[model samples]
Target: MELSGKGGGSRERAALGLTFVLRHGRRTGLASAARLLQLFDVKIHHIETRPARMPQNPAEDLEFFVKCEVLDCKVSSLISSLKKVAEDVEGNREGKAPWFPTKIRDLDRCHHLVTKYNPDLDCEHPGYTDPEYRKRRAFIADLAFNFRHGDPLPRVEYTPQEIATWREVYEKLSSLYPTHACKQYLDAFHELEKYCGYQADSIPQLHEVSAFLSERTGFTLRPAAGLLSARDFLAGFAFRVFQSTQYIRHSSSPMHSPEPDCCHELLGHVPMLADKEFALFSQDIGLASLGASDLDIEKLSAVSMHLILLGRYRTNERTNKAYGAGLLSSYGELMYALSNKPEYKPFDPDVMVIQPYQDQNFQQIYFVAEHFEEAKSQFQKYAMKIKKPFPLHYDPFTCTVEVLDSPQKIKKITSHVKEELKSFEKLS
Candidate 1:
C-alpha cells in the first residue's frame, strides 16, 4: 500500500493518531510482526517491500506504517516491541551493526565537492579549474582514498610551495593568538606548538595532529579531498571523527581561503577539538544533524557555518571567546568578524538555523555563545527536538561505530565499563 502525501493525510494522521514508518531487512517475518502488532491494538496502515540499497547480504527491505491513537508511553512501547521483533528475526548476527539515520547514509552516495570539476571561480578564488589546482585536487583525492579506519593515518610529503604557504599563514595567525584567542584555545595551541611541531617554517602533518587530538579528547581526524557538504562533514563529528583537508590554500591568497584548507583545519579547528567541553559541543551539533529532514539539514548547516565563522568575536561588554576555527585561524576574517560593524545575538538554534549565509563576504550576523559549557548545555537541549531512533558511540580500540539499539544495551555497555574502571581503581 502507498502512503498519502503530507497535505492529504497529515492533518488526518494528527487528528486520529501518529504514523511511524518502520523498516527492516526483507522476509524477516514481517507478516508475523504485523499480526503481532494487531494483538497490541496497533493499526497497521500500510506495508511495502523494496530492494535494499547496497545490502551486506541479499535481503529485501520492508517498511511498515503503523498508526497509533494512544499516549506517548504506549507509542514508545510499541516501537520498542517492533525493534525487538526485527532483531529477533536476524538471529545470531555477528558484529555490531552501525546504525544511522537513513538520510545521513544517503549523503554517503554523493561525490565530494573536491571531486567535482567546476571552472567558474566567481571571485571565490582563482584557478579552481586551472592545471595546478586540478593537480592539487587529485592529490587530495588520493589521500582520501588511502584513508582507512582503525589504521595509522597516511602521511603526505609536502612540496616546498605548500610548506611555504603553511609558514606564512602560521606566522600571521600565531601573532594574533595571544590577545584574540580564548583561554582554552590558547592552552591547546601551546600544546600543539610544543608537541605537534606547529611552528613557522614547518608544516604539521595530519597524522601528528590527529594523534594529538585523539590523546586529549577522543577525537580523530580523517583526511578529506576538500570541503564536504555540511551534512557529510558534521556527520563525522557524531563519531568523534573530523574530516580535514591536507591542502593549503592558494599561495596568492594566504590570508583568505574560500574553502577550508590545512591551515584552517590545523589552526582554527584542531585546537578546539582538544578541549573536552568544546569537543562535546561540536558532537552535540553533529548528533542533531543525523536523521534530519532535507530542509532541516540545510538550516542546521547554516547554523554550523555561522558558528564556525563567528565563534571568536571580541565584544567590549563581554569576555572574548573564540569557538569557531575559521575565525580563529584567519587573520583577516577574525578581525572583520569581531569588528563593530556586524550584528551580534545570543546563540539561538532556532534563529541561526534559518539565518542566511554568504561565502563571498564576511557574515553580517554572528551567534555568540556565553561559554563552551553553556553552548553544550543549550545545544543538547536543542538536539532533543530532532527525531533519531538510535544512540551512537565510538569505540576507539576498534575504530568503529556502535549503535545502541535499546536503553538496556546502553546501560549494559556503559555500566560494565564503569564497573571495570572501579575495580582497576580499587586494585591500584
Candidate 2:
C-alpha cells in the first residue's frame, strides 16, 4: 500500500509500468527509447509502437507504450533516463489525487458542486430580461440544486407555451433525423419515444428517460441547475453518470441557446449516450481526468466538449452523420457541420486540445471520425498524454475507481483480466 519510494532506498521489490511519448522532432523516437531502457537496471516487460501523425509534423511518428520493471530504488533514475530520449513520461506509481465517486450515493457530494461557466444568466441570455421567465427558470434550477441521488427526479408540468416550444423544436429535429442523424441516434430516439415518452406534446421526464438509458447503457442522468464546470460534468461519465439540465431553454430561442438547456440534454445528449461506443468514448474522457492536474484539465476540455461535437462525414457518396450531443441538439449547427461549407479535419486530439471553442457561434471546423470506435481509440491514445500520476480502472459493478497503486491492487486486477480473457476464449 505504499508508493513512498520516490525511486530510492529499496531496489529489490517494487516494479513499475511506464509509457512515454517521444518528441516528433526526434526522428530516433524508437531507437533512442530502447537504448535508454538498457542504460538502467530496467527489465522490459512489454513494448509496442503505434505509428501516429500529429498536426505539427506531416511525417509519421511512433507512440511507444513500454511496460517495464525497475528496481524500486532506481525507478526515478530510469524515468529521468527515459525523459532524456522521450518528450513525456507516464508511470503508474505516483501523482496528484483528485476526488472521485466510488459509490452510487457518493454522487450526492457533487450535487451542489458548481464549476460555474457563468452560473448566473448573462444579459445576452435569451430570457435574462424576463422576470417571469427567470422565476420559472429558478424554480426548475432549484430542483437540480437541491437534488439528492436517491430522490425522485423532478418532474416538470409544461405550460402551453413550453409545450409549444417543445413541439416546434421536436418537429424540426424529428423531420431531420431521417436524413441528418446517425443510425444509432435514430434507433435510440425511437426507443426513447416508445418507452420513455419522448414526443411533441410533452417533455419527457428525467426519471423515465434515466431509467430507460440506465437499462440500456449503464448511464443515468442527474439534473444540473445550468452549465456545470467542465471538470464536474466530465467526472460524471467515469461512473456512467450524466449531469443533465432540467430546465428547457427560453421559448424564444428554442432552436438555439448559449448554454445547455433541457432541450439540449434530452434531445441532443440523451439518445446519443445510449449508444455503447459513444458512452465509452465519454467515459474515456472521465477516466483520463482522474488525478489530472489543473492545466491538464484545461486541455482536456478540447475532447470533453467534443464528446457531443464529434461527427462522421464520408468524402464518398455515403451520408455524413452527426453523433455528438452538441451538434445534434442544435438544428442549425447540425446542418452546417454535415454540409460541404466547413473545413473537415480528422479528429486529432493533439490538435483539438488547443482548438478554441465558443458558446455563441457554430464551430467553423468539425472534427470527423469514421465511427465512434475510431474516435475512442484515437482519443484514448491522446488521453495517455494527460498527466495522471498513477493508473486507474473503473469497475462498473461496484461503480468505483480501483486505483492500481499497490501490488495487491495490481494482482487483484490482473486476475480479473485473466478471468475475462478465459470467458472470451470460450465464446470465440
Candidate 3:
C-alpha cells in the first residue's frame, strides 16, 4: 500500500511505485526501461528483488520492486513505455491500484498463480497412488505450462483406458440431457455433436472444439493442467476464455471426478459455450472479478459459486433443468439437484453471494432463475451493485479492462453506449 501526500499538487506528483516480476533473460528489457524513465526525468528512489522459487523448479523467478517519483504530466508516457518492456507492471495500490491484465498476451502473468489442490501438494488426490497416472498428469501439465495464446492447441493422444473412461461419463450425461438438461444446454449439445464430433466413443481435441466456439460466440478454450483456484479460473471468463483440462478422469472413478477434466469441460462447459446468452453470463462473472480487492475477489470467486446462478434453472414450478457446467458434468449431482431432495430458493444475489460451498458432495441448496436471459439480467444488476471506487469495462477485442477512472474515460464510454443505442433505434 502506498501513502498519499496531503496537498493536491503533492498528490498529483506523488512518488509512483511498481512491483513486477522479471526473468534473468529480460534484464536487458529492464535496463532499457530505466533509460526510458530517465527521459521523463523520473527519480528512482528504491529498487529491490526477492527470489521466488517453485518446489518443481527451484530457479523460477525473482520478483522486482521499484519505486520512482515522476512529474504528473510524464506519468502516462513513462508507464506506457514501461508496459512495452516489463512482463507485468503493477501500480502501488494505496497510491495506485495494482495492475490486472491490459491485453490477451498479458495473461502469461497469470499462468503461475496459486492452486488449492495440486497433485504434488495433495496426497489425498485420486491419482496420487498411481505412478502411471501421476506421470500422465505431469506430462499434460508441462504442455499447458509451455502453451501460449496463438500457439496451436496441443493435441493429447488419449490412451485406451482414458478414452474408455470418457465414454462412461459421456454415455451417462448424454442419457440425462433430454430429461434434465436446460433448453440452452440441449441445443448446444446437439450442435457440438454435429460439428465438433462430440461422441461417447472418443475425446474431441481441444483445437477442434476451440475453433468451433470461436466461430460462433468468440469464446475460446485454453488448456489447463488441473483445477485452478476459483479466482484464476473465473478470471479467464472475463476474456471469453475457458482454462480447460485435457486429461481424462482416472478409470477407477469414471462415475465421478474430484477435479475438472476433459469430461467436465467437453460434456458440460463445451455445450454451454455454444449458447451466446450463456457466453455473456460467463464474462459477466469474469468482468466483476477484474480490479476487485483481495477480499472482494475471494467473495466473488466462491460465493459467485457460478453453479448457484449458472447451473440450475427453473422455468416454472414443474420444470427445473441443469444449465450450469458443474451440474451438467456430474451425473450424481445432476440427478440429486433435479430430485425433490435439495432445498430450492429464489435467485437473490445478496443472499446467495454469502452462501458457503462444500465441494465434496452435492450442494444442499440450489438457486434457480426463470431462464438464461432473465438470469443474466438479474445477475448483471447484482454485479453492478458491488460498489467499487471505479467502474470497468472489458473490451473483448483487445482483451483489456478499461477503468472508468477519469471523467473523459467515463464520458467516452457513455457516448459509445448512446451511439450503440442510436444504432439499435435505427434497426427498430
Candidate 4:
C-alpha cells in the first residue's frame, strides 16, 4: 500500500481527507498530512517530499554545517538588499498599501473561491455547505484585500503621549543594548494608528468577540460557561480585537518571549480575523483550549505552531497557500519556511498532538490542511479530547516570576499580572 493510501480528486476532497487523517490521532500527523496531499495529487507540492537525509552520522556533517554560515551570511545580505529596495518603495508612498503589490491580483481570486465554495451544513455535505464556511470565506477575502499592497500593514500613528512613552522605553532599552533594531521599534510605534488604527469604540464586546473568534479561529473559549468559561480566561479579553499593538522583534535578541505582546498577537493573528471562516476556526480553538490541562495546552500550542507556522513556511514554494497573519508579518520567515530546503510532514492531528518541538527554532514539522473547514472539523471532531475546564493553567507560585523595577519607574508589567491572577482565581 502507498504511504498516503491511493488517492486523487478535487483539491477540496483531498484536503478533507488530510483533515480526517490528522484528526484521527497524534501518531499519524506527518503521514496523514503527506498522504492527504498525495490523495489530492499535490504531494509534489511539499518541500519535504524528498527531504534532506540526515547523514548516517550527524558528526560527519557538523563541520559542513558550521561552514554553511558563510552561505547564510551571503543570503542574509541579499535579503537585506531586497528589503532596502522594498522599504524605499514604501517610503515614497503616502499610506500603507491594501496588500502586497505582488499579492493584489490574487485578492479577487481568493474571494471568488470563498464566495463560490463557502461551505454550508444545510447542503448535502456537512463540511462543504455550512453557514460557518460562508463566514470563513468572508474572513479570507478581508485578509487578501487588506494585504495586497507592497506593504499591506496599516500605518498606525500614535499620539504624542504614546510616542513619548515609546521614546522613553527605547532610550532605556538602548542604554543596555546599543543596536539599530530598537530604532525600528521606536519608528514603528510612532507610526501606529497610521498603519494600524486603534478603535476604542469599535472593540467588539467580549461575548460577540468570543463568538466570532471562536467560529473562525477554532478558539472555543466563548459563551463563558461549561467545561470552558470565556469570562474565566485571558484570551477572551486580550485576543478579541483585529488590531495589534505596534512593535517588532528586537533583531538583536537571541531569546524569544511567549507573552502575546502587541506585535505578535496583534499583527500576527488579527488580520486573518477579517476572514470569517478562518477567524471562527481560530476563535474556536482558542476558546476550546481555555481551562485545559498543561498537557492539552501544549498540544494546542503544537497544533497552532504546526498549522500557522507551517502554512507560513510553505506559503511561497509556489505551493501550500497561507492564510494566517503571523506568517504575513515576517517576509523572511514566510519565504524560508516554504523554501525548497524545509521538511514538509503530512497533516495528521494525532501526530500534531504528540510531535516533539523545540520552542527555540521555527517549527521543524508542519501540517497542511486542504481548506478552513478541514481544519475546523478536526477541532470539532476532537472537541472533548482537546477540551479544557479553563484556559491553560500554571501554578502562580512557580509560573510567576519577578521583574526589576527602579524606584522612579512605574510598574508597567504588574497590571497584567493581576489580570492573570484574577482569571485563575475566578476559576479556582
Which has the greatest TM-score?
3
The ten-residue window of minimal lDDT in model 4 covers 61-70
Q: The CA-based lDDT of model 2 is what?
A: 0.75
Which segments of model 2 are wrong by more than 4 Å? 1-95, 111-121, 313-317
TM-score of each: 0.68, 0.75, 0.80, 0.35
Better of 2 and 4 by lDDT: 2
Q: How big is the positional error of residue 192 in model 1, measured in Å on the Cα after superposition?
A: 0.9
Q: Give the Cα error of residue 399 in candidate 3, in Å.
A: 3.4
Output the lDDT of residue 288, model 4: 51
Worst 10 residues of 1 by lDDT: 88-97
lDDT of each residue in 222-250, candidate 3, tens digit only: 88877776667777888888888898877
Ranking by TM-score: 3, 2, 1, 4
What are the candidates' C-alpha RMSDs?
10.5, 15.4, 6.1, 25.7
Candidate 1, superposed: residue stretches over 4 Å from native: 1-111, 114-124, 313-317, 390-428
Which of candidates 1 and 2 reaches a greater lDDT?
2
Off by over 4 Å in 4: 1-234, 237-248, 251-261, 312-318, 387-428
TM-score, prediction 3: 0.80
